[model samples]
Target: MSVETDKIEIAFEQLVDIQNTIDTVLKVPKNPGHIGVRDMLRIIIGPQTDSDQEKLSEISSNFLARRQFKALLKSQTLASQTKQAAASSKTTSGQVRRSGDDFDLNLIPSTGDDKLFYMQLKVKNHERFAQISKAEMLFVESKGVFSSVPLPEILDGVSQIMIRQGHPVLDAFHDPEAEFFIK
Candidate 1:
């Protein structure tokens, strides 16, 4: 076989070994709830001396750094796509108009005459609102004026406003408690 083919085979074998090591480490009863890369590496390498543990730690750090770099690249791609889509949809009139089918407006609160004033504010200024961050919105919603409204109702109103204003309505931040796991 060519040198390139041999290198590929070696890489595949290493990947299989790593996977088996991960499986074995996960099966250990003494392992912590959240396992760091070093912990996993130490478990796999079975370090007998201080020097061995230090070497394993260095290797784990490099592995984690590479993984983080890859994750950043993926996140950048997604962010770029989202930005491009948002920019392309913009009109000269300064208003973003999305087709009803593009997003589910019904996912958020319904704004009627009887709705709370704060809910109306959320519905009106979904984009460029004072409480832009999710944590800030949650804190604000916990107060007396906004407290009466359910969190979902507030989020729905906010989401509707955001969708109308041509901003990305990240459901993860809006309703974190919702089960999104695939069955």
Candidate 2:
């Protein structure tokens, strides 16, 4: 076989060996179920390094924050578009195209006896709001709540929370504290 073919065969064998090891460690049944890459990595590495853990935490926090930001931006854009469409339609036809009362913000039921009902309903359906609240809490705890904190500040606070949670990556090259400058 050619050198490249030989190398590919060796790599394939190694992958099979790793899979067998994982199956053995996990005590897979006669018919093994699917195993994901993260599970395989955990089995191989045994335990993550502090640096690796920190990086993972930072990535997760950034992902959540960015997702929340994007959701907010999308909601605002849609609302603006809806408003513009309604206005244009009204100007053309001299009649309201949509009813303002169609949507109700108040969560009060007809009975109006339960005070916490609205809060519970909001929390149950709005998971993204909960995540944003947690992120905001981290920022407030780190640096007291500001009248208007910038987006970067919020992201920095999320990073700090990850560091405080015992995932400090102190390696020289990948040190979290090291500052990067662009020339």
lDDT tens digits by residue: candidate 1, 37-112: 5543332323333453343334334645334423332332211111112222334543233222112112333264
Backbone atom clashes (below 3 Å) for every candidate: 2, 0
lDDT by residue (1-183, candidate 2, tens digit) is 699999999999999999999989998466233333453233223343434333333323454533443333333221111122122122232221222111111111123333221100111113333343232211100111101111122231121211211111111112222211100
Question: Would you estimate the TM-scores of all the predictions?
Answer: 0.16, 0.15
Query: Which window of 10 residues has the lowest lDDT sum in candidate 2?
Result: 138-147
Clashing pairs in 2: none
How high is the CA lDDT of each candidate model? 0.31, 0.27
- Model 2 misplaced stretches (Cα beyond 4 Å): 28-183
